[model samples]
Target: MARKLNDIKSDVDEKRFLFHQFFYKNIDADIEIFISHLEKLTKVFIFSGIIRDFFVFKNQKPFRDIDLIIEEDLVLEEIFPALDFKKNSFGGYKIKFKTVDIDLWVIKKTWALNQGQLKFKFDYLNALPKTTFFNFSSILFSLETKEFITGKDFLRFLRDKKIELVLKENPYPELCIVNSFYYSDKLQLDMGDKLKSYLKSNYTSKMNVESIQLKHFGKILYSDEYIRNKIEEMFTN
Candidate 1:
C-alpha cells in the first residue's frame, strides 16, 4: 500500500496508506501523544526510518523512538517546554517525554551548511543520500499530507545500486564510515572509489585504527543489526 518512486502522487491514496500503518501496530503510547500534539504544530514532518519500516515492510522492530522535523526551532521550545530537551552537536534537539525520545530536528532552508547562511529556504532532500533505503534518509511523513514521501532512490534498494556522494556538506559523520562498511559487507557493493578517498582525506583519517575498527563495524553488532536483517529480507525474499 506504500507509494513507490513511480506511483502516482495522490492525497486520497496516501491518506489510506498512512491510516493502514497507523493501525499496523498498536501506536506507541508516546508517539500517540506526539501525534495528538501534531494538531498544534506548523510545517512539521516525521522523517524517520520507522515510517518506512511500518509502511513498506511492516516487519520493523517495536517502537524505540521517532524523529520529527519542524520548520521552527523556537516554536518547539514554546510547545514542549515541560519536556526535557537538549540541543545536540548534530543539528537536532533531543526531547524526552516518558518512554519516548522524540528527536526534534529543525529544517534549515539552505541545503548546504556554510557560514553566514540564511535559513528558511533549504530542501531537506539534499541532506540525504541517493543510496539504498537503509541510507535513503528522507522518508518524511509530513503533517500537512498525513502521509509519507519516498526519496528519489527509495526503490533502488531493489536493484544493483550506486551511491552518489555529495558529502562535502554531509552532517552525519557516522554514515560516511559505518554505512559504507555495512553496504560493502552485506550487499556486495563497495563505496565508490571517489567517496572512499573523500572519507579517508576528510573524516576517517582522524580516528585511530582501533577506534575506526570498532565503530565502523561495531554499530552493526550493536544498534543496527535489525537494519541488517531487514536488508537481508528485502534483498533475498
Candidate 2:
C-alpha cells in the first residue's frame, strides 16, 4: 500500500523518504534509471503539479506529467542517451517512459523567466514559486538532495483547499483564468481573495475563449457559453 503524506512527520528526512516512496510506487519507470541520470546533473528538481497532487490527493489522482527543472545547460541526448526524447511546444524535452510522461527543461529557459514574464533572481529555486499562476503549483522537490522548496503559502493553500494566484502577470492570462476554473472544479477548492479578484477583473472582452481552448486543452473541453457562465458565476458568487 502507498504511504499517506499526512502520516509522515514534518521532518525533512521523513518527507524525503515519503517522496521517494511515492515516486517509486506511482511512476511506472525504473527508479534506478532516473536516479542515476539525475545524479549526473548539477541540480535537478521535480517541481509543480506532481508534488502538489501528491500532497493533496496522494496516489488517488493520475499525474498528467512530471515537470523537471535542471539548473545546468546540457543536451538531453547526452544526459539520457538511453531514452528517446523530443522537444515539447514550450521549449522543454518530453520523454515517455512506460505509463509516465516527463517534461524537463533548463531552469534558465523556464517560460516565465526566460520570456521576462517573471524575473530570475540569484536563487533560481527560490524564484520558481513566483512564476506559477497558482499556489498549488508552486512546490518544488529537489531530485538530488531530496528536499522540498516551496513558497510560504503553498502548503497552507493546499491544506485549506484554496486556489490563490501566485503571479498575476503571466504570459497566458486567458489560460490562467481557464485553469483557475478547471482546478477549482476538479479539486473542489475555493478561490482565494486574490484569485477571486483576478477572475473578476480579467474575465472581460479581452479574453479569447477559443485561443485558450486551443493553447491549453488542445481541444474544446468546455463550451464557449459554459466557460462564460462559469466565469460569471465565479465572480458574482
Candidate 3:
C-alpha cells in the first residue's frame, strides 16, 4: 500500500501524501483531548499501529485503534465519568473516544510483566521503537508535543517502499505473524522477497503452510480491528 515518493508522480499520489501529512499534523489534537482528561502525566505517546497505518503503510482502511502509552498510570474511571471502559484481556484499558477507540497501555512501571514483552523504565523514550515488529512501525508521536521518535531504518525503509520484518530480538512474534497475514492478504500488499523468505523460514515448518494457517487462523490476533471490535462488544453490557 506504500509507494515510494519518487514513484509517486501522479497528482492523485501527491494529494494522498498531503492528506496523510495533514492527518499527522492533526493527530495531536485528538491526542490532546485524551491528555486533558488525565492528571499530572509528564509524558504521553501514541505509537505502533496507528502511526504505521497513517504515515508508513498508508493503508486505505481507516485506523482501527490508537495505541496510547503514558509515563504514569491513571485510573480511567476518574478521567471519564460518563463512559465505561473495558479492560482488555491483556492488562490495559480500551475506551472509545467518540467514534474511534483508543487502547491505553502503560509502561510506567514493570507492572504488565508478561513473557515475551519488552521492559522499559518510566521515561525511557527510546523504548518505543524497541518494542515494535518492523522498523517502519516503530515511530511514535508525542501526545503533548510536536516532537516524535522513529526506528533506526524507518526513513530508509519508507523511502524504499519496502516491507521488512525486523529480526532483531522480537518481543512480540505473535503480533508480527498476525500483522504480516493482515497486510499481505487482507490489505492486498505485495511482500518484499526478504520478508517473504523470513516468514517462510521462521513461521512455516516443514513447508506446511496450511498447517501454519490452521494453528494461527482461528486464534486471536493482535490487530487493531481485533482489539477495537472486542472492546466495542464489551461496552454493550
Candidate 4:
C-alpha cells in the first residue's frame, strides 16, 4: 500500500534521532566516494532528481539516482558501462543507467540548442559563475562542501528582484510534447525510470531543458495554462 504522507511524517519525526545518527555515517562516506569520482572526470556537473532532493530535502533520505552530465559524448558512451551502469538510449537528449530503483541520466553537450548552447561555452577557469543555491552549491559531492553553503546562500539564490530578473526563453518544444505524452499514459510510473525511453523515441524533436542530464524541461516551459489543461485532460479520460 502507498504510505500515507502524515503517517510517514509522524514516524519520521519520532525516530528523528535515529535518522540523524545513521545520516552522518552513510552520508559522509557516500559523499566522499562521489567527490573522489567527480574530481577525476572532465567537465562534469550533477543534475536531475538527486540534485532536486539534495537541495530541497537536504540529503535526508538516500537519493534514488546519481545523474551526471559529461561534456564529451565519447566519455558518456565509453565510460558509463565500465562503471557498472547499463546504458540505454533516452529520448533524443539523455541516457539512462538503472541501479536498483535509482535511474541516472547523462546528457551530452549540444543538449539544449534553444538555450543558446553558448551559455555552456564559458571558460570554466575564468568564468565559472559565482556559486548559487540551485546552480552551484546543490551540485555538490562532498559533505564538507555541502556544509559550506548556508541558509543565507539559499535565500540569495531563490530571492527574485522583480526588476532585475533575467529569464531566458525556453528552447525545447518537442521535448515538452514528448514528456507530456509519456506522463499521460503512465500515471503510476516514476518518471525517472522511463525518462530516457520517452526521450529517445522523439530524439529529432527539440527539447528545451538544459544541463547535461535529467534536465527538467518543466522548469523552463511548464506554464499554468499547460499544467491545468494537462490535469483536466487526465481526469476526463
Candidate 5:
C-alpha cells in the first residue's frame, strides 16, 4: 500500500507543533514542585544537549528531557520521588513525570592521573549536555535549582554581547577535547601538548583569545576529513 506523502509531513509537523505547545504553554504541579526542590541544591549545573537545543536552535521551546548536574552525591531515589521519577545506578534517574520523559543523571567529579588537576568529567553519562524532558515550569525549576544556568544562558547571552563567536564555546571544552582525542595519534608529536594546552586554556581553565584557532583545531580534529576535504574541494569546483 502506498502511503500519502502529505500524511507523513502532517505527522511530523503535528509533533513539532505539539512539542512547541508543551514547552511554551503547558504548566503543571509535578513540574512546579520539581523546580522548587531543585532550587535548594548547590554546586549543580543544568547542561547537556538540551542546553544545545536552547543555544543552537530557534523557538525557545521546552525540551523533551533535561540534563542536570549535581556535584555532591545525593541519592536520586531519595530526592526525585515527589515528581514521579525513579532512580537507577547507571548513575541517573528515570522519571515518568508528566507528558514528557525525564532521564536525570547525577554528576560526580573524579581525579585524573594524566593531569594533576581534577578532570571534571561526567561519571554518569560520559557526556555533557544530557537530555531529558520536562514541562516549561520544570525547566525553569531546574534552572533555579542549580543556579548554573549562567553557563547555558551564556551562549544566548554572548550573542547579545556581540562577541561574534559562540558563547557556550567558553564552558564546553569537551567540544574542543574531542578534536584532540581523534587527532592525537595522527599528530602525535603535537597532539598531547595541544590537547593539554587546549584543555587548560579552554576547558579545564579559561581564556579569551580573539581568534578562531581553538575552534579551527576542534573542527580539524573531530569533524570528518571528508567534510574538510569537500569544503576545500568547493574552491576548485
Candidate 6:
C-alpha cells in the first residue's frame, strides 16, 4: 500500500525505516552491497527520483536508476578499484550493475551547485533539494544516518500528486522542460501553474529533440508530436 502523506509526516522514525526498507528490498542485491561498501568509505545519500518513487509506488514499481551524493572527496578508482565506471558529462560517475545503473558524485560537484546556478547559505545536504527542477525529486535519503532531507513543498506536492517547478533557472532548461512533461505523464501527476507557464515560455521550435534523446541514452518515451501536442494543450487549457 502507498503511504499516506499525513502518516509519513506524523512519524519521522517510521518513515525513515520504511524508506530504508523499500530501498533495500527493491534494489538489486549486488548494488546494495556496493552501496553498503561505499558508505563505509564516505557519507553517501540516495537522492531524487528513487526516493520519490518509494513514497508514490513503494515496492510496486521498479526503480529506473539510483543517484548518490558522496559527502567526502575521494578518488572513485581507489574505492571501486575492480569495477568499471564512466564519467558522465555532469561530472558524475556512472556505474552499471546487472539490473540498474548508479550515478555517484561528490555533493559539492553537483552540476547546478558547482556552476553556481543555485546558491545556498547552508551545507550541501540542505542545498541538495534546491538543485532539483521539481519538488517531488528534491528529497534525499541518507544511507548512513537513515534520515530523509526534503525540500520546500516536497511533501505537499507529493501529497497532491502535482508537479511543480522548484528551480526555474537550470543549466539544461530544455531537458528540464522535457522532464517536466515526462515525469508528469509517467507519475500520473498534474502540472502546477508555475511549471505550465515555464514550459509555455521556454519551449521553442528550435528545441533539440535529438539532444533530449541522447540524454535519455537514445530511449524515446514521448514522440515529438506527442510532446508538441502536450505543450500546445497546456496553452489551450
Please list the Cα RMSD from the true structure of every candidate, rounded to 1 decimal place: 7.5, 4.7, 10.5, 12.3, 15.5, 3.1
lDDT tens digits, residues 3-64, model 6? Answer: 67666566544689877887898887789889888888899998887877767776555778
Q: Alpha carbon lDDT of residue 16, candidate 6?
A: 90
Higher TM-score: candidate 1 or 2?
A: 2
Q: What is the alpha-carbon lDDT for the whole of candidate 2? A: 0.74
Off by over 4 Å in 4: 1-38, 41-44, 71-77, 80-110, 113-121, 124-157, 160-237
Question: What is the TM-score ranking, best to worst?
Answer: 6, 2, 1, 3, 5, 4
> Per-residue lDDT tens digits of candidate 2, residues 1-237?
533334332533356768867776776546447856676766888887777777777655466878888888777787678886888666688887776678888887877888887656687778887788888877788877778886656755655668898778876677777888788887888889899888778777656777778766788666667777876886576
lDDT scores for all predictions?
Answer: 0.51, 0.74, 0.55, 0.35, 0.39, 0.80
TM-score for each prediction? 0.61, 0.82, 0.60, 0.37, 0.38, 0.89
- Sliding window of 10 residues with minimal summed lDDT for model 3: 204-213
Segments of candidate 2 deviating more than 4 angstroms:
1-14, 30-32, 78-84, 88-90, 117-120
Q: lDDT score of model 5?
A: 0.39
Task: List ranges where model 6 is wrong by over 4 Å.
Answer: 1-8, 11-13, 214-217
Q: Residue-wise lDDT of candidate 5 within 108-212, one digit each (tens)?
A: 431121122333343332223222111110121134322222222233222332111221223334444443343334223232222343344543223222123
Clashing pairs in 6: none
Against the true structure, whose TM-score is highest? 6
Candidate that beats the other on TM-score, 2 or 5, i.e. the better one: 2
Error of 1 at 214 (Å): 9.1
